[model samples]
Target: MTKSIEAMWKEGFVNEACLTAPKINDLYNRKSQNIVDKFKDMFDINIKAVIAGSLIMLIMMSFIGAPFLGIYIFCLLIPLIIIAKMELKKSVNLSKGQSSYDYLMNFNCWLESSIETYSGYYKVFYPLFFLGMAVQGIVSQAGGKLISLLVEVLPTDIIILGQPYYLVVAVVIVTLIFARSAEAIYRWDLNIVYGRQFKKLAELIADMEELRK
Candidate 1:
């Protein structure tokens, strides 16, 4: 009778584990999906906003594109566009069901990486664009006006081998400042969009781990 009772107890524990595993998995899936869905939606909104803003920028550039080097810089941006596409695909995969903590962990890393890469790209993109505008002006038949203007504005004493050292220094300094500011702004915008959702995911991971304990 004791042996039969032990056998029954063993079967009951196995059944309990079988039932509990799916329940825990379902909980993880449902909670993770809720957070992931929200994050994806937020990213989509940012993308739309960015696209609209970029169109406006391109429209403004078109005013000078034909007359300047803007078109070349714009053309060079194909790689950045490709990177964005790859990141979008990565996000699409991220939206799939994941019942383990590893999913959230992967997501956390991806979020940081995405924000850094996207922001850093724009830092390079913006300066190249502004510099391209200068090159564009110089290459255009009407471009002498810009060089003359720079010479007229910069101090005469700051000349280096007939070129204005002060102007070069000023442009470099300004571009660096602009690049840093663009990076900061991009980082802030991303944080604004996805920060809350990321925090929620972290919380979910913490809670789920605690329950496991």
Candidate 2:
């Protein structure tokens, strides 16, 4: 039964490829195939959101003495991650063969379903995410100040090796590196997926061009 399902999927893919082959070729030859812009915009939005939220959290942590702020940020992030995965799946499905019109419809349907499914959770999630960042900033600042005070009391020798100021600096540097790395990974994954889809589209176009000749 699994084999049959696989075969059916392959057959559908082939049929869709054949049907869209000419259109795909035309789109490619137009010298304005800037579909990457669309994908880039989507990625940019997510990056901006994450960065902005993280900065807010950092500020809050600096001022407050609450670890719960970090927890709240994590909680809000969970739903965003879920939404992102859903969007990725929809994009993959659309790239596979669905027409833009159909893809839009399907995407909207999925979005609606997701909203309904997570409505109750989001009501709590968004506010917490925002509040958490505020709290995190406060806590982080407080933590930094506390460490500075501790360092001040330590022997000058110990201060040279592992001062609280140094620790705080290290943490900031590490956080920035991690954020950049995460963005890079996301971009790489997106490029790999888009490259494969484009290659397949190109092959279909070549076949259609040959047939036309």
Candidate 3:
């Protein structure tokens, strides 16, 4: 005919939890949607970045070649294009997953791979990029405008060693310089381009983990 005070409080607590469950789920759901928006925007940015890189590479190609430089620039661009495609796939895969937590975890990993990919590319791109310039210097030094201008300006031979071999030595020196500098340059570029998105994705992953718990 009557309930105890303890029983009443327990029943009220259970009722509140039951009533609030859907709202709780809805709140967590917003986290996933927000993550999706951030990642989609990131994907678009990556696409634009790749296109811009391609244009710059094309411009460089117009000037960079003694054949060796042209070939090297072409080779260097292939990995960048591949990374761009992979980034797009990551966004598309997460676009409409059923569970927020699932996609957030996936996105966290995707971000990690992106960093790894760029770091790996760094170890490759910087040296090769400068190699094109070195080759141009070598090819143009003999009879091109640079040499002609030097003759007109009043100078002696600038050869540090023999002709062809000296130029080869210069190329080796340029390659070594960029090899040492690659990590710093790569990190700088990475910070500029993807730093904000990486941090946001990590935070979303953390929030999703906490919410699921």
Candidate 4:
């Protein structure tokens, strides 16, 4: 009788384990579907906003006698469009349940291509980034010169305080504020992108674990 009881318990445990696998799989599938749906909504909103903002800027520039600025904006925007297209393609591929290995291989290839393209533009981008600081310096110096010229033209009563000193102080404050804000934005974007990538990697690892089980 004891032997028969032991055999029954073993069979029950096997049945329970077998039932749990499908439950776990269903849960994972539902979670993955939710994530994909969220991404789709976000991507749609982002693309719409980008297109609308770009069109508005283009139209405004034409009316404001700044058509050249619009053209420059288009030139800068093309690379971003290409990047978005690549990312969208990858996202679609992932959503289709393509094999993870294949998806990763394609993603790596896309990244390599992007890096090559960016390498060609690295010279220009680096200079542009530093140009902000250069511009700040030029603006501060110009402010000082303007203040000096104004002081010369004004009557002594109007020049009660040292104008150049005040102008320099104002320029320094503006420049520092601009620099700090730009740096903060850059860091925030970097962190957000990195975090998303990390989350995707974690999900892939979990999927692999499920497969192993």
Candidate 5:
């Protein structure tokens, strides 16, 4: 005549009086721990993917004859991995010895904090990334030949820092636009990569909150 945990959970949900305080607390802990464990696994996978992507980018850039740009991007990527690892470390220790509700709350706060931190970095990073690409394009062999063709056909008088003034202005404008849209771009990226995980986390938090009421 012992009830299964699932039956107890259902019974508790239907009529709270059927479950003791310890049983309810244990169920909450189990549910939250399952969600948190899944999140941790996904986070680890995401970090690994980023590290792999950075290596691929470096190799591709080097093969494409943009060693300086490759190095620059590699350096930029290092900090991203570092920051993610740091956040992961913090998350690992975040909810130790805390109740299920408190643990979920801490996780929610950590997610918000992590997103804000990454968004700030991406805001600066996106503009710089575009600018670097622009510089590499203009200084490449093809760019030199194209410049020569333009010089033959168009007026060579419109120069700024030995480059075409219009080209410089265009690069600057494009970079500015990217900077302005960086947050939206980051959100889009996040949605593409981890939208389901985030949705599940939000739902788990909401359920926990409702259970506490």
Candidate 6:
């Protein structure tokens, strides 16, 4: 009855391979968690840097007679930071007991949504930022003198209603061109900042998927 006993043992006994499934899943969980933790760390640093830079710019602008530029940029960025911080909190609070793959997928979706949201904001902010700089330049001490000099040299045909229509047209055109490419520019900037972390996350997800198969 040895063959019968062997068959019964095979049917009833658990093996090392069976036990390994949970360990493998746990490993994936840890790896996925690490990837997300790294992203959060990077994001936190960026936020702090933005805050410090804004304060520095405000102080420098106050000294240089362009405090409005500093205030304008701060106002534009503060609301964005507030919204992002709230979203970050929500991501961190995702329900427990999710599969590693599902968690990563959720995070990926969140990242894409965040990028799109920021891109929408950039569409308006980028144009206003450029336009504001143009205005700042025109009103600066050196810029005011330079414009006066140019006004004396320019033809009256280009000056309409006592305003330099050509300069206005040039500024608007440049701002429009920059605005048109703002999303691409922001994506490029994001890639530069987070490319390595994003690549690791994708690779980890692929590995987990392959293991499942």
* Residue-level error in angstroms, candidate 1, position 207: 2.3
3 or 5: which has the higher lDDT? 5
- The 10-residue segment with the lowest total lDDT in model 1: 8-17
Q: Report the error of model 1 at residue 175, Å.
A: 1.9
Q: Candidate 6: which pairs clash?
A: none
Model 3 TM: 0.64
Q: Which candidate model has the greater lDDT, 3 or 6?
A: 6
Residues 1-213 of candidate 5: C-alpha lDDT, one tens digit per residue: 897766555556445455544577677778778878887888899899889988998999889889899888888878888888988888898855866778878888988898898899899889998988888878999988887787777766789977877778888999999999999999999899778878877887787666554
Give model 3's clash tally: 0
Query: Residue 129: error of model 6 in Å?
Result: 1.1
Best candidate (score: lDDT):
5
Least accurate 10 contiguous residues by lDDT in model 2? 28-37
- Model 3, 57-104: lDDT tens per residue? 666766644555655676787787787787667657754445556656
Q: Write the per-residue lDDT of candidate 1 for residues 23-97, one digit (tens) a residue.
A: 555666678777877887876665665555555556667785462343455464655666676776787776454
Q: Higher-lDDT candidate among 5 and 6?
A: 5
Q: Estimate each model's TM-score.
A: 0.63, 0.35, 0.64, 0.47, 0.83, 0.84
lDDT of 6 by residue, 44-99 (tens): 88878878887887889888889999898878778667766866776787654676
Choose the strongest candidate by TM-score: 6
Whole-model lDDT for model 3 versus the true structure? 0.65
lDDT pick, better of 4 and 5: 5
**Could you tally the backbone clashes for each prediction?**
1, 18, 0, 0, 0, 0
Clashing residue pairs for model 4: none
| Models ranked on lDDT | 5, 6, 3, 1, 4, 2
What is the Cα-based lDDT of residue 37 in candidate 6? Answer: 86
Q: What is the lDDT of residue 69 in candidate 5?
A: 92
What is the C-alpha RMSD, rounded to one decimal, of candidate 4? Answer: 9.6
Q: How much lDDT does candidate 5 score?
A: 0.81
